[model samples]
Target: MAEGALFEFLCRMGDNTLVLGHRVSEWCGHAPVLEEDIALANTALDLIGQTQMWLGLAGEVEGKGRSADDLAMLRDAWDFRNVLLAEQPNGDFGQTMMRQFLFDAWHVEMLAALTRSSDARIAAIAAKAVKEAAYHVERSGDTVIGLGDGTTESHRRMQAALDLLWPYVGEMFLPDAVDAAMAEAGVAPDPASLRPAFDARIGAVMAAATLTIPEDDFAHKGGKSGFRHSEHLGHMLTEMQWLQRAYPGASW
Candidate 1:
């Protein structure tokens, strides 16, 4: 496969974790319970750790001499290749877990596929990330069930979250040129192939949660393409990139 294609694929992987990690980090100290606060913090840390490996490899593949931090903290929104799902705002605690559950379901499958990547580095990174992702899906699924099947208000909010976030889920399985290259090279599975497993996983969890997925079949696109992004990304970039932008060469 072309090196450019590999770099694009890596960016997609790294950017997913990076953006979602930041969103989850926002829950620190704001979760409804102390345990959840800690859990969210750890989840964010796990994702950021995976970000280091993924973007680190991405930078190496690009051979631009950019570090992972540069790719993560210096890039503009239009340059990011994360799916639109990962960038959605964490509306409420229920919404946050719903988003996490949805993404985690997709993520677990993605990482599992990557662990078998033809590229050794990709395989290694996925092996480590898949472990954390397993836990992420489990915890998020439980939270989804707890909130979705709990009190009437919790159930209502959880259902609302599912309705709002479901459209974003389709983007995870949407294939683009970059995804095609990755799959053809055996560096990743065809994005579409992962859909069946992802569906089965989420279906069981949502059933347990008693949450009905939206039947819209309509998905928001553009984030992975880097041709378009939601307004939320630009705003997020301002805060996420500010420190690095303010101090160009500074580092810890």
Candidate 2:
């Protein structure tokens, strides 16, 4: 039971990175500038690489024949455990940056805490991942601050994006049974325990950007439970899993 719970927790972490990486990858050719285009792609690659590590570890823990590729390429949207925030549509540049910033802030905090996990595999992965996540926080936070405090139009759009994405943020800190088990085992940090630091980091960014943090505590959940997901995830899977679905066992 403990192993199963750890596997699930790892998958949830991988799914979050995989789904969000795919979302960010969508900007590869469409970013507003060449520098940003490269930046987003680099960030996407970092996230996808992290997903590989976490999901690979999960497959090992499950003692199943499934490889990381099998898990990532074969899962249906309902089986994915990524948060809704990661699956949200990148409505605009501002929205994308806001979403990225929000996730990055929490991600860095989570990874830092996970580096001390009793599970050596998880700890090693988190230790390496926290470095990339710190850079991600810096990149996204800078973008948010720049755009949020920029011209009138930019500022308005940044605020709007924050408001739109805030509700989803609460889900990041909400602890469920799986989290409780992992935390108890010292395999994972308690989600609630990470919230204070997350809040402090994100609040500092928003304050610097002159943007208002949403006041509501209401959160939408379901993704971590592997039972619900945004409509965007289905479409995303169509593209991400197409090659594997179309050509079983085929590889480059």
Candidate 3:
């Protein structure tokens, strides 16, 4: 892959975690249960920590002076490259679990494949991330199964969550030109190649949960190209970047 393309790819990877971590962090002290509150907080920390590693390496690759903090706390929402799913709002508990399960499954596959990346830096990061991703998947999957198979109200909510989230899942596997180049160069895994496995894993979780995937074929796109985003991102960034943006260059 071209150096610039690779840098962009890394940025997308980092941005996904950064945004999703922020979303999960919103659950801190507000989850439906204390156990889940702590669980989501820890999950958020893992994702944010991954964001630091990925963005720090992106800076190294771009040969820019920017640090992970700069990328995480400075960039505007329009510049972010996370998949639409990652930036999507956390709805009810079921929706949040569904979103986490979907991303966790895909992330595990992506990171596992990335551990074999020709780029040593990428491989090292993926090696560590895969473990965390696996745990995320297990936790999310179990929660989904429990909720879906629980009360009638929970079953309804879980089913609705699955439907709402299904379309966004497509974006995770849509490969662009940059992705092609990186895959060819062994610096990145082919996103499309991860689709079948993603589908299988997701299907298994859904089956255990007794939830049905949505029938809608339409899917949102363009977060990676920065051409499309939900309005939620601006609000999210306003809060996430407040300290850094309000006091530029302020440090502890």
Candidate 4:
């Protein structure tokens, strides 16, 4: 049971990275500037690479016949364990930056905590990923601050992106049964414990960006716990899973 739960937990992490990576990769040819385009694409590659590592580990933990590709490409939208924040549509450059910033902030905190995980594999993966996630957080945070403080129009767009993406941010810190079990088992970090660090990092970035944090009177939650996601997830899964669905066992 512990191993099964661990596999599920790892898959959830991988799925979030995979889906968000796919969304960000869509901007490669469409970014507003060449440098920004290259950066976004590189970031997407890093995230997808991380996903592959996590998913492969998950497959091993599961002790099942499923390969990493099978777990990623064969899963339907309902079966995916990714958060809604990852599936939310990338509205504009500002929106994309905001989305990435939010996730990167959470990831940095999470990975830092996971470095202490009792599970050697989890700790090792986190140790390696923390460096990358730290850079991701810094880059995205810088982008947020630049756009938010750049000009009237840029500020407005950045503010709007923050407002739109804020609701989904809550899910990152909301702990679930799996999280509780993992925390108890020492296989994963308790997300709740990471909240303070996440908040400090996010608050500093928002302040530097000259952006106000959104009010949380009604925080939207329920993603990793397996609730349905935003409408965009279905479309994303269609594109991502189509080849595997259409041609079972097909590969280069």
Candidate 5:
């Protein structure tokens, strides 16, 4: 954490929600059931709402006069700070829910810790957000459990999803300089510090679902650091930012 550590940390928070919200929104009308479609849509809306608050604060902290929309739509892939997991493709309904459950587990813990952040604004935002996050985790956990313990086909797909997702889980808990500074300042917990709780939460759900965690703990990195990004994210940004980039400043 150096001169712009807070700005960097804020971007990481905002970018996670912004990117994941877009990913979740992709399920709007394509969900397997009408109930699921509506639920996913609402979940996407909640994530995007959280994005506005996080990015709004990021923009303010940066003092470069960029708005949330600018940070989200104006920047290219390498500028993003979301974990690699958030940008991963939605393979199937089962995969989608699996991704949601994993992230939701970490999210609930992260937001709960933020509720007591030394920064009042951060604490306030987390206080409001923790409520939505709680529901998100519970719903996702139930879905994971249901599909994991369901019929053979359902269980097979869920197990596959869990394997694909588990590797990415490590990145969320990997601490960096920004995290150290945030923790030191009492603004946020070190990402690593959240891992034990995340592990316990997921372990129980996985056991109920009867899914196995992958053997190798190989974690991908660089997305949050802006050093590198997966090919998927560049493509995602092309669509998400197209409207903003094509017609700069166009708005209702």
Candidate 6:
């Protein structure tokens, strides 16, 4: 039971990184500016690297015949455990930045806490990932501030972007049964515990961006804890899983 719980937790982490990384990778050539394009691509590469580590750890923990590649490429859309925020369509440049800003802030806090996990391998992975995530958060926050406080059009677009993505943001804080069990075992941090820190960081960024937080009283939820995802995820999985599905046991 412990191992099963651990595997589930690890898969959740891996899937989140993998899906978000792929989403970000979509901007590799299409960013509004050249410098921003490079920045987004770099962030995507970092996330992809993080996914490799987490998925490899998950494979080891599962002690199954399945490898990281098999798990990542063979999984269906419904089988993915990433939050809806990560899989949401990249609406515009501002929209992408808003999504990244929210996700990176939460990710930084989660990785920092996970660095102290009781599980040695998990701790090591978190320790390494925390550095990467910290930079990602900083860069994303800077972009949000830049665009939000820039020209009138930029400001309006950024505000709209924030509103569109806010509904999905709640899922990052939603705790699941696996999370609860891991918290009890000192293998994971409570999602709720990270909220204050995440809020503070996000607030600071919004302030710097000269933007107001959305006043939506009712926040949408349920994506990571097994709720259905946006329509985008199905298309993403179809492309991502095609190779493995088409050529069973195919290898490099």
lDDT of 6 at 115: 95
Per-candidate RMSD, Å: 0.8, 0.9, 0.9, 1.2, 0.9, 1.4
Candidate 5 achieves a global lDDT of 0.92
What is the number of residue pairs that collide in model 5? Answer: 0
Q: List the residue pairs that clash in candidate 2.
A: none
- For candidate 3, lDDT tens digit of each residue in 99-209? 999999999999999999999999999999999999999999999999998899999999988888888888889998989989999988889999989889878878888
Per-candidate local distance difference test: 0.93, 0.92, 0.91, 0.88, 0.92, 0.87
lDDT of 1 by residue, 28-131 (tens): 89888999999999999999999999999999999989999989998888899999989999999999999999999999999998999999999999999999
Q: What lDDT is reached at residue 199 by model 3?
A: 85
Write the residue-wise lDDT of candidate 6 on 80-132 in tens digits.
77888888888888888899999999999999999999999999999999999
After superposing candidate 1 on the true structure, give the runs of residues whose Cα lies further than 4 Å from its correct spot.
none
Candidate 5: the clashing residue pairs are none
lDDT of 2 by residue, 83-103 (tens): 989999889999999999999
Which pairs of residues collide in candidate 6? Answer: none
Q: Where is model 4 poorest over a 10-residue stretch in terms of lDDT? A: 217-226
Error of 4 at 65 (Å): 1.1
Candidate 2 achieves a global lDDT of: 0.92
lDDT of each residue in 64-136, candidate 4, tens digit only: 7777898999877777888889989889999999999999999988888888988898888889888989999
Q: Output the lDDT of residue 27, model 4.
A: 97
Each prediction's TM-score versus the true structure: 0.98, 0.98, 0.98, 0.97, 0.98, 0.95
Where does candidate 6 stray beyond 4 Å?
Answer: none
